[model samples]
Target: MASESSSSSSSSPASPASSSSFLTEPSPPHSPSLDATTSSNIDIPVLISGAGPTGLMAGLLLAKMGIRSRIIERDMAPTPDSRAVGTHARTIEILKLTDKAVYEEVGSQSWRSESMRFYFGNSLVADIKPKPSNDSEFHVPWMLAQTETVKILTDAYEKTGMGKVERGWELLDTKVVEQEQEQVEHQQAEDGTTQDVKTTTRTTSWVETTMRRAIEGTNKRKGESVVLGTVDMAGEDEDKDYEVKVVRSEYLIASDGGRSTVRHRLNIPFPGRTRDYNFILFDGHVETDLSTSHITFINGDNRHSVGMFPIRDNRVRMMLDDGTLTQEQFNAREPKTPTKEYFEKLLEETLGTLKLKVLSYNWLTYYRVNERRAAEFTHKRRIFLAGDSAHCHSPAGGQGMNTGLQDSYNLAWKIALVLNGTAPQSLLDSYNEERIPIADEIIKFSAKTLDNGVYQGWLSSNMKRMMLSIVPFLVRYLPNGRSRPPFSMLGLRYHENSVNKAHKSQHYPVTGPASIGQRAPDDILVPFTAPADTSVPRSEYLAELEEDLTDQPIPTRLYELLAFPGVFHILVFAADRLAKEKDFDCCLVKDVDHYQRIWSSRWPGLRGVLESNATSEAMMCKKMKSTPQFMVHVISSATPSSFESDPNETTTTALADREAGFGKVYIDCEGGRLHERYGFAGVSTKKAGGGIVVLRPDTHIGFRVSNVESAAWVEVDEYFGSILVN
Candidate 1:
């Protein structure tokens, strides 16, 4: 479905001879000219007007939901340019829900190293590692060309067979007309009952057409289909259906881009100011022999900055200089100051005269950095905007493409729901309410990065050099304050909603309101019963547990019990009651002694501190000393049966029984009457029996536990408790 090949050089216009074919196709199955009553019977639920990554992804998700969509694109074929090149961990997790193969394939092609070194004039100032912590769930950022990413998405979309993208079709206009009934006279029958006669009324129609010449290779002109229009945008009351005039579906999305035609038609202001900065993007095959595998940023001169990211096999992507340039200057036929020459000078100035050679060129483009946010992303209830249409900011953190793709992903599902009449129109309001704030935040963050100037100054150059020399030591030992930006895809969350509000205040720390929808960090090793019956060795317990708990769900009751509003949960496991008893009996110690030792050691000063302040002593003690007791009560679904004699033996037997009945209980608990009310699903498998699972309000697991003494467990709890309470 997605194949890469050499780009064709031909750029011919459509020929007139092909006009007849465009006009002669069979009438659409449900044309606008048909009677409104008859047309209502056909099921054409969704119509998308773009086939880029966002549109394709939305279509793919719709297909997964068993819904059908038609995508119309103005492009005659897919673009070969490799635009946005970074994929965050959060996107990978979202994709995993519908297409694991695509996730795995894309993940296998990510950049794993931590730091990105910048060489500036006689100095190396900033050694930036976007996310430096090894404890993060998404430890690496992926760098793949936008073209390739779209190719993968297209392949996945086609496999669904529930949708098809029609290239070359464009949207024209939309009009709405109410269906009316004809007046008739009433006649009295013999029984004195009035009989009404029915008559046909005029039906209003919304016509949509596509120009055959607009998409053809030759200058051929022909008008295409006139079909009924679906809701392009909905007003506050979605129940009241309206028609939109679509002249060309292919170009419909252009109105959503920054320079929106629809906005112009409606006389709406875009309402954002553009910053005074420009960025030049160059994509080409280079002849450089630099052996370094990591991305290189050259920052020395205050006037310009250079960033080089590895694309596919041999090609690389480079962004240089900032600020706007005229079209003539950008596309000079003679190429007096080429990108290669610019990079060479930058490398020499920053790295102190390093030998680098230039090879061939592929594509070159320039963009002015515009830090603007739309006043509102929707208008008049008939038009909605997403991606660049809603917000545009500097590409400093490589967030532009990822952010746009995610925007489309969020909108597609809601659109499908509205189209299918499953969700109320109010759901649509959440889009702007949720995403506009994020866009503002992104713009602010990008502005900060721009202000840093470390990516283009002498101080930054020196700092980068020094950091690169000491990175090995810094990464191994002092990794606390020296981490990268927390720009995880999973870090994004929808907090201003009822569903998220129900979560306890301290349930998901690293991934609460601040990090909702983010992938839970991989650092906290989770110990779960191995799905297979093979005996787990003590030495391999933590390692195997980490592997088993990688993507498991956090238990729902955990969030309920913590009772924190829109916060994260940190669960600490103390010594297993049965194991502590065994140790006590073997050493002839009292139960209280064992409890004190386990509580003091695992939870340490936290208990004493809480006890000193009477306000929290009971809760602290319960969390530290009596967790197992609380666990017994919460794990009621396991229906754990305890025996006083040989506590370890009894606990082990009960665990086995719970595992045996796991599937049924999990289904009933997560899907039965109880699960529906609570909105909590059991962890997918029964393997979660003998551990503590930190759950988010959304029921996603953030961390898990088996042994109480593990440092990871302690860290998880501390992290969970440290989240900001909002």
Candidate 2:
């Protein structure tokens, strides 16, 4: 990382330059001679604006791509407050891709546990259980304070060795000067004689050069280069060829927190309402009998919710709502001033007299639930907004910091592409298309969550009162099932316009939210195969295949076997091989044979496609015949219940028998439900070759195809073609 001294002299802003006058005619002037030496000295691109996280991230991406950028920050010193804390799995994955060691060190050591509890007055209601894992669609949520997250990211940025964040420099104004093209004018030309000649004539002309610039400044910081001279905008030397003036960049990303200056300047409307509930958060040391756990959310009569988690060693962080104290009161409360008696009282009121003591208080902050999102995340070509700058909501979901970091993650790659001249500028439009719907959904879900937490009293409390009044027996028997709403961080899915096509569906039947294009879940996948080989099992083969593809070894193959490139997959296992063969063209026997021959011929290439160790005797035989570029496996058997370890054991008997040879047979196994789990309900049992299965790359089903001959290949070809880049 580039380290510079904080001591540096300040530079004054230059005078405002005249704006380009394109709408009016240019004044006639004498052309001045330009010197080649001065003209050649100008840099094509240079520093232009503030050096906040957004700008710095952009600069880092650009630098990685070998582009030059200078970042200027208005802040004299970096703030130490823990503004945002949460980091999403996606962001972690992205950062891991960039710098594995740094990402792991920062992410792994952050938070320890998470749990949620409910309360009704002084009584404990119930502790909420995390949603059961359906598949590897989501992972457990992790928490980290915001200040630490920023420090890590900033450190990574400085380490890139491209540009340094020139703090204390602010953007004052911008003007366009000598743009590539100004305007084109067309006019009618006069004829020799008005009545004698009736010939039409035309003339075209170009407008003069446009120039613009404004003034800004930078504060002195130790150990940094500082310019002492005042930059004068009006004092332009005539020898310069290209107009030398400061101009706005092609794009501006507003990651300036919730109170975004860029969003305000753009006049964008933030649409949403703030909730009345307030929260108090503190970072400090505490000791208690309760061993460290995931997260503790205590909700009861005092109507308070506290989240306590380990940060480092004995240091812990806690978030709780003291309903009695307003934002002002909470802010005014001094650290270490609140006595142990006061903390005990607060805990008794909030957590039903929990036995815990506060050793030290580091930081205390008050926050209100403000659920708001901008109507538009982008404006024109000049400005784009993200993170708290674009959306804000209750910290209950812990989405504030996570969402912002993801915003930068999503936008950074796109910006890098545009700046590097790889992707067209139009690609930027997809940012809004993909992210807006997500923000809107989060807002809706958060609102519902808040409502559920705050409004359940009317019915539950009254019922409890009535039950207690009638008989204590009935009241005691009634299940105390009040639990926190399912706030799994993994629950959030980018079903719409997500690059992952497999997770496009609303939900995954087997694993709940394992939609198409969503992240595959981590699970212990049991494997089954026909013609079971004692040497290698189906699970081993699938595991190898996954490892070969991703490099990272997955413990289980949670996704379907057949997946389209960049799409989801839905694998269907038929009970019998004849039934599977029947789904092909039985009527067109020749065509079926020819296609089978072709598949057999291409089976060898399939070896390359297998993830890892996904080789079986049957697969080996298939590979011997021909290598397919990509092929998924499925076992078929007839005896639904009798079929156990090996399906191929009875394959000879089934295929030789006349009735069972061409008929469909149901197979009973734990894995048989895999089809139903993935929403493959409409199978055509009447005809042998009538059932069709659809697949997405991430192993989610998009749609199924049935009763088709060569059309299946066509569909597969088309789907893969759209996603894979060769």
lDDT of 2: 0.43
- Candidate 1's C-alpha runs over 4 A off are 1-43, 109-114, 122-136, 174-215, 218-268, 289-292, 301-303, 322-352, 379-383, 419-422, 453-484, 502-726
lDDT of 2 by residue, 497-594 (tens): 42334322223443343344334332333333233444655345434433433233332243322221111232324434333343332433333334
TM-score of each: 0.59, 0.56
lDDT of 1 by residue, 156-219 (tens): 7777787787676533322222334454668898999999976665442222232322322321
Give the lDDT of residue 595 in candidate 1.
Answer: 39
Cα deviation in Å at residue 575, candidate 2?
A: 12
